[model samples]
Target: MDTVELARLQFALTAGAHFLFVALTLGLATLVAVIQTRATFGGNPVHQGMTRFWGQLYIINYAMGIVTGLVMEFQLGLSWSGLTEFAGNAFGSALALETMVAFFVEATFLGLWIFGWNKLNRWAHLALIWVVTLTAYASAFWIMVSNGFLQNPVGYRLDGGVLHLADFGAMVANPAALVAFAHILSGAMVVGGFFMAGVSAYHLSKRTSEQDFFRKSLRLGLGVAAPALMVTATFGGMGFGTMQVTKLAAWSGDLAAAQAEMVARHGPGDWLPPVGWVQAGGTWMMGLFALMLFVAAPSTLLMLFRPVVRGLRVWHWLLVAMIPVPFATMLAGWIFREMGRQPWAVYGLLTTSEAMSPVSAGQMRFSVIAFTSVFAVLVLINYWLLARAAKAGPAAVALGDRPIDAPQPVLTF
Candidate 1:
């Protein structure tokens, strides 16, 4: 492969790996906040246990996400210096905000939430998690702002070959960004819901002692996932109208027109994206969304019957198998979004080949190998830690002071 292809491959691997971590972190953080809120107000021991157990998983994923995000930052500078040189004035603003929100504000609140356990007032502790949750979504919002600019190139003007931010409001209010943000958030909730439900099903199928704990968790997971999936689908459909005409035409299999239009605008060249690959990504994403909704809605209804909930051994295994569905769906959607616009790094403004740094193919090759290896290790370690903690059950979680055998009744508001 040439330098451009190698650079694209490297970014795809790192970005894709980081996204998996971010999806779970975003979803699980919200779920943990909800569970913690219930624990605080309803004074339920099971809810408290649920919060700690799921929150640990959220922390594990969040920590690894930070590492991958840093790697992504380095990659942007290392491989795509042209993008920075050309559009940094406009694009860099959003990335800077995301860094502040994720690294400073979100991290500070999460740190307090983790250590504030039992030390701070219950209400104060509850407030911390909500802050972390909001900031997490805020961070994601800014990122979409940056990505949306690439898709639509809004709120910017060309000056001396550099893109300048002409209207910050226009950029923030980009229809492309707003619709994509809603779609991403709802999709994240679907990921979180399936993860929670699947983990609970694993425990339930094992006939663990904390039957009440896992059962409640399973119900919450399916309930959140069912509605979130519908919202995700809705926002996803809305996103189509905001897409570039070339992308929409290409996806609809009218690639010749898209190619001819691009040639007319910018002169003859390889003007079309990889149409088959982009279409395949969309196809897989839609199919998985349907499958997950089908399973989740019925499973949620079935969970209401106590006898059925306890005795559905086969169904529990099925739920466990369904855990990976949303993750796959999210990745597929990401590929469709990112790759569908390709050949252009900044839509009609800059070609991807032009955005890459002036590096040797060998250098790009080495970077790809090195980054992929590191990401693989991080991903494996993350899953290993999560699996170990999850399999250990609520009794073994270290988030709070209350023990299963503690002399005091679990704290009540």
Candidate 2:
């Protein structure tokens, strides 16, 4: 592959890996906040334990996610200089808000929430997590704003061959951005729900002593997942209507006309995206959504009964097996949304080939290998840490200020 292809592959791998951490972080953060709120009000030990246990997982994911996000930003500067040079005024604004405003405030608040666990007043600590949750959403919002501009190139004017931000409101309220943001948030909730449910299921299947704890977690998971899956599907459909004509035409089997129209407007070049990949991504996303919804909706109802909740070993294993489904579904949808607009870094305005930096193929290849290797290591370490903490159960978590002698098995393994 050439420099462009290698750069694309590098971005794809790093971005995709970063997204997995993000999905879990967003979803789990909200759930942990909700659990903590309940604990503060109701004063239930189980609820408190739930908050600490799940919050630890959230923190772990959030920490690693930050590193991955930084790597992604670095790649944007390194590999896509043309994108920055041509459209930085318009595109960089959203990214700037996301990083400087949303991300900065979020990290500050999360740090307080983490270290402020026992020292801070209950209400104040609770407030911090909610702030963190809102800022996480803000981060996602600004990012989608940036990405949506790439998809639709709205609210911009050409000034001496460079794009300038003409209407900030139109850009922020872009239909493409709004629908995609909704879709992504709901999809994150689905990821969170399934993760909580799956982890609880694993513990319950082992017949752990914390049956009540895991049981409530399983309930919360199914409750959130069932509705989230439906909402995700709804917003996903709305996203289809906002697609650029070339993408829409490719999906609808009208690529010939779309290509002709593009050539007529922008001059002779291939304008259609890879239809097979786009279609496959959409198909896989839809199929997984159906599967998850079908199981989660009914399982939500079934798990409400005492007998099914306790004695159904088969159901427990099923939930455990379905842990990875939501993650895969989210990734598939991302592929569809991104790859559907292929060959254009900024649709109709800038081709991806033009967006590449002036780097040799060898440099691009080396960067891809280095980035991919580091990302793989980070991903593995994240998984190992989360799995260890998760498997250790509530008694082993060290999130809050505990006794110094308290057995912190999660740290060891």
Candidate 3:
């Protein structure tokens, strides 16, 4: 395989795997934080147990995810330095800010929260968890902002070889960044909900005995999942509606300019539509996006309203399978977001071809193979580890102070 293809394959495989772990961490971390806060505030053992259960999973997933993520970061410089340097002024700020500022707070507060449970007061203890949670979300925000820039570059001016910051305020205030952050945060919550539901199901299937405890677990899972799923569905729909309209406006102008150019070149002889077809096409795409949103949102809300299904039987697998469909639909929406900006990496700043590295197409092919194989193996291992972790129950995996459990996908974004 050519190096370009190899790089693409590697990125794809590793990105998929990393998403599994990272999404879990984001969800799990928030969950544990919630539990910790509730236990401190409400004096509830159930919440404390919830904290312990999810905390172990959080640590396991975050550790692995950070490692995988670091590798991805390194690969960016090694394999795609061209893209980086080309847009470094715009992209680098977000990257460096995320790592240097956001991450330090997360790491430090996470340590304090984990180790300070007994040593700290009720308010302090709860505060630590919140700090960790806020830092984690902040970390995610910065990362997403950088990615939003990729999907819709803002506040950038093209220099001879690289893009420069035209306005930092514009980057922070980017409409795309706000919606992307909401989408990502909601995905994390959905992951946590799935984790709770899946675990509840596993225990419920084993026996009729202790049905109450398992039922409580199921309720606990749904408690977060219900609200989150509904809101996420709604929130994503609104975001897409806005995005769709915005895209229509953008394309309408582009097509108008293109058509005008054609008319100028061909004069009145050219078959330019008497009416502006560009506006019509733009409206059609907008409607299509709205249709996708309608299908995706209501269905996801339906998942929220689903009656609790306990047990690890065939039905449980079906539920798990059903869970990702809305997310997959969201993926389709993202495909629109990315592809709709076709032919340009940063709008009019640079073409996609210009951003491509000096590598052959054949290399990108082999890289895909390697990335795929590696991901298959990692996912298999992840499932094996999760099964073992669940077998032992949350308490066993998070005994005393440290973590020794395999990560679970619970959510993939």
Candidate 4:
């Protein structure tokens, strides 16, 4: 692979892996928080015990996510120094803001949640968890906004071989920002919901003492999962919609500019539109994305919207299919969105090929091999842990406010 291709591949694999962990991390942490909150309100020992139990699992994912995410930060400087050097004055500011403001805030609140349980007041302890969850969400938002600019390259201009911010409003008002974050955040809820509900399902099937507690968790998880997952899918459609319009807008401008060059000689309507392939491809992909959404809705509505099939197996599997559908659809949409705006990393500024590194053939090949190997190891570990946890039996595990063991009996005189 060339250096650019190699770097892209590494980042793609690593980001996807990180996303799997991160999706669950964000979703499950919220799940744990809700569980604990109910216990505090419900005054049930089973609820409290269940909360502590599930909380342990959530904490593990959180730590793993943080550790794995560190590598990406290092790679930004090491592998993509070209990107840094070019956009550092501007891009670095946003990245640094995320690290200092969002990341640290999240870390600090997480510490409070983990360590302050015994020392802090009841409300304060609960507040810590809430703070941690919100900070994580906020962290995700700012980071994605920065990335949004890369995909669309809005509100900027070229200056002395570097792109400088032309208008802050364009960056801040990027339509892609909220839609992307919403789509992603909702996916996080799905990961969290399925995990929590899956555990609860096992408990219900086995008839554990904590059936009630696990049931409670199952209800809460599914409740959140249903809407969040649905919304995730919906907003994914919305993001696609936004991208479709953006594709048209981008193509129109490019076509106009290209036509200007040829219009004088050809006298308008130069046989084909300047961006024929791109506009057509974007429209076609958009239609395909709509079909995917249609396939997704039935499952979402049956499993999430209605209570009639609350514990039905067929419905559950249908919902399971919907879970990953968004990934493919959104990816398709993103392909069209990013590809449509090609030839420039920042519009009227740096070209994508220009922003690439100066690494040699050997360096690129070796880097790909090394990063791919690392990615494989990480994926294996993630699955192994997930499998082990799955086999442990959710029935036997502790959950909030639920009785896992059998009920005690008393003899009457």
Clash count per candidate: 0, 0, 14, 13
Model 1 Cα lDDT, one tens digit per residue, 171-251 = 999999999999999999999999999999999999999999998999999889999999999999999989987778768
Ranking by TM-score: 2, 1, 4, 3
- What does the lDDT come to for candidate 4? 0.63
lDDT-better candidate, 3 vs 4: 4
Residue 198's C-alpha lDDT in candidate 3? Answer: 59
Write candidate 3's Cα lDDT for 1-413 as tens digits. 44644564476456556666776677777777766777777877666666666676676667667766776777667567677879878878988898888888888887776666556676886787777778778888888778778767888888786888899888977777778688768766766666665566666666545455445555565566556665665665665554523254444454466445544754543222212333444344345434434433443443343343443366444444444443343344444455454444555455555566776666556556665676677667765776577546644644224332334325445
lDDT per residue (tens digit) for residues 360-402 in model 4: 7678678778877876786677667654654364433432222
Indicate the TM-score of model 3. 0.73
Q: Which is superior by TM-score, 2 or 3?
A: 2
Candidate 1 clashing pairs, residues 3+ apart or interchain = none
Per-model CA lDDT versus the true structure: 0.90, 0.90, 0.61, 0.63
Candidate with more favorable, higher TM-score: 2 or 4 = 2
lDDT of 2: 0.90
* Cα TM-score of candidate 4: 0.75
Best by TM-score: 2
RMSD of each: 3.4, 2.4, 7.9, 6.9
Model 4: residues >4 Å from true position, as ranges? 244-344, 390-413
